[model samples]
Target: GPPRGRELEVARLVRQLARERIHNVVFTAADVHYAAAHYYDPTRAQFRDFEPFWEFVAGPIHAGTSAPLPMDNTFGPQVVFSKGAPPGQTLSPLAGLQFFGQLDVDSRSRTLTVQLKDASGQAIYRHTLQARRA
Candidate 1:
């Protein structure tokens, strides 16, 4: 999670991007010791001046796994998918809670595909996004 005031900064940036007509902006992050997919939509956000976007989170390929944290609603983020240890529990890497993510971009179609995989390299969740034309 970001420190205090960071979300406001992000909201400001989002509004600026919308003013510039930027679209299909995606964000990826790790280090939460879990895997999840979130979708942010201005229509459902507290700050509603930006377009919808996607944020992918994954990590801890070889470390202990922590439970998913509560999401902030400043950006109106909805959890599309999430996998993590049970509440109040931590799983070691050997417990098979490890995960990794893959992203593929196609220039011809201007699309982005995101996949979250387990230790065995099997995809557990997948999503594809078609870029908006400028």
Candidate 2:
């Protein structure tokens, strides 16, 4: 998770981008000991001046797995998908809870695909984004 002040600063930047008509903004993060996908909708945020965007989180490829954490509400993140250890339990890497993410961009079609894969390289979750026309 990010510091609250920094998150707010990012929110302001996103608001500025929205005012400039920017679109198709996406964010990625890792090292939270879990894998999850989040969608941020300005309409649902405490700060409502930004456009919608997607965030993909993945990590702990060889560490203990942790359950998903609560997202800050300033940007209104909705957890669209998540996979991790159960509550009050931390699974070791050998437990098959390890994960990594893959991203593929298709320049011709202006699309991006994201996949969260397990230690054995099998995708457990996938999502595709179609770039918005300028």
Candidate 3:
């Protein structure tokens, strides 16, 4: 996601989803060689009806990890959490800082837990989202 790369397209799609009463949406992605959590709050935006959702960035797996990507403010994105290479580390996929993300869902509780971890599966960050059934 290039900040606001496809602003109009994303906005249009989100609006459609909201119109269908689908509010529990979370956009999970990878390939940016970093990990971060973002929240898109509709209250701060022009489109007031869109439901708030999260966009989770995870992975590169064995590839080198880099710094976190910048957020696009078109959707009023807020950085909830972010983790990247240690201070002074260079940005490269071959930096031996491979990472990955996992999601654990508990249907009974209606909760989704996201974890960002290193090669050893040691979690670097964790977030839990509670879903509201329509």
Tens-digit lDDT track for model 2 on 1-134? 33276676886788798999998888888859999999998777887888899989888867899898777778888999999999878988888898899999999999999998988999999999999998
Highest lDDT, which number?
1
How do the candidates rank by lDDT, highest first?
1, 2, 3
- On residues 74-131, what C-alpha lDDT tens digit does candidate 1 reach at each position? 7889999999999989998988989999999999989999999998999999999999
Error of 1 at 80 (Å): 0.3
Q: Whole-model Cα lDDT per candidate?
A: 0.88, 0.87, 0.77
TM-scores vs. true structure, each candidate: 0.91, 0.90, 0.83
lDDT of 3: 0.77
- Highest TM-score scorer: 1
Tens digits of per-residue lDDT, candidate 3, 1-134, equal 23254676788888889999996799998857777888888876655557899988876765666677565556778888777786555456555567778999999999999997876789988999999889
How would the candidate models be sorted by TM-score, starting from the highest?
1, 2, 3
Candidate 3 backbone clash number: 1
Clashing residue pairs in candidate 2 are: none
Which consecutive 10 residues in model 2 have the weakest lDDT in total?
A: 1-10
